[model samples]
Target: MHTGLHFISGLPRSGSALLAALLRQNPDVHAGITSPIGSLISMLLREMSQGNESAIFIDDTQRKAILRGVFDGYYGAISQTQTVFDTNRLWCAKLNVVAALFPNAKVVCCVRHLPWVLDSIERLTQQNRWELSKIFNFDPGGTVYSRVEGLVSSSGLVGFAYNALKQAMHSEESDRLLLVSYETLTREPQRALDAIYDFTGLPPFQHDFESVTLDANEFDARLGTPGLHKVGNAVRPNERQSILPPDLWRRFEVDSFWSEPAWNLRGVRIV
Candidate 1:
């Protein structure tokens, strides 16, 4: 067996938690709101393979076992029988590591346009205007320009995942990657789920759209974001207009790089 493991990753605020909540409705699948495993994986990758001279002593076998162990260690609480879906915004960047550890694993990536991704975060920050979300801690005093720049920088939230997803789209293991666009997920969820189920060879389960929910209050509050991972019991389109300044939103209006016809040849099956 291939460990019955998979991942949910891509842009934040792009319905990753909602997807997890819907999938968790499946009795045989164990899905959770965003997990820290991706951060842990990144830490291990740097420590074991990139940092100090001692990393030279860590061969591929040992590195693989250690990296793979992070999943076993964090998910040790779940019964081995349940199919697992780990969520992280960074997993798209680490497909190479995942391929090494779990060859059969697939990553269900949720992506949104860059302008909307920025708009979504801005809306949340404005909602909690009195407080600061830790997400912007690196640049607490940044204005809309700085914030957008930071977020779209090479290592920023959207840029890193965008580059990584593009890389994974072209990698030899491309077959194991599935892209679920935020628009498609919201407007046509059944089609999105169907594509996901078919991609991973998981028997399709009817997810109750109206009854889906995932409570992440404690975690969200700790990060000073009260509704960061909140999902409605029912999945619906977000008709809310961007609360960001019109100029800011307009500046990033052309953020949907994946929509280009040239990208169609990359072999990424976007739903």
Candidate 2:
């Protein structure tokens, strides 16, 4: 029973994927692209809730067991020898469940400036000119403005993740959360990794930032977005001019709440 578990979550287009790739270098750790366990847990919860006619037969204790078993069954074999770090944007929204199930688990959130996050996604969409992105429901028509609007809508990817992070920041479990800014992760990867190790209560291990590698071609292809999870051979800042219109870029300038110290009421650790 490998009880050592943690989570990797935060906004997309951040460095979650890259962090996972770098963490893979550690022989004692296990991490990868987002997994289906988050969705699976939701489905299981619904099935065991009052929505199900058979819910009367399942008790609270059994419910907890089933939920915990999902983690055990999914990663038990590999986690027996290595610490597990599950990746999912939904984890931030489910901190209450996390507390009940994995009380000691820490959540490492990869964050970035809101404008840059949107810019990265927009660049990916443009790169795949011939295909429709599942991010926008695979619709064939929409301008950059429209796409941006849709992505920041209440239920949109960026919007939802951003909102969930805010919710996590104010939760009682906020102390269990660690925010790793994309800039630091890229420009000062060693320091970022050191903070992460300290947060997760693990010993440090050497990581080859210069040779970090990841392949998500098949996954990105299915989503009609190429190189979405691609990582460079070296972990260094890739500064570039923003392709977004001036007005659009400026609109989200104030959205990176994590950058503002005043917004961190809970004093959640930020790297």
Best by TM-score: 2
Which residue pairs in candidate 2 collide?
Answer: none
Question: What lDDT does candidate 1 reach at residue 188?
Answer: 88
Per-residue alpha-carbon lDDT of candidate 1 for residues 149-246, written as tens digits (9 for 90 to 100): 87778887777877877777777777778889889988888999999999888998877777878999999888887899989878888888776788
Candidate 2 structure quality by residue, lDDT tens digits, 88-187: 9999999989989998899999999999999999998998888888899999998989999999987899999999999999999999999999999999
Span of 10 residues, lowest total lDDT, candidate 2: 1-10
Off by over 4 Å in 1: 77-79, 138-140
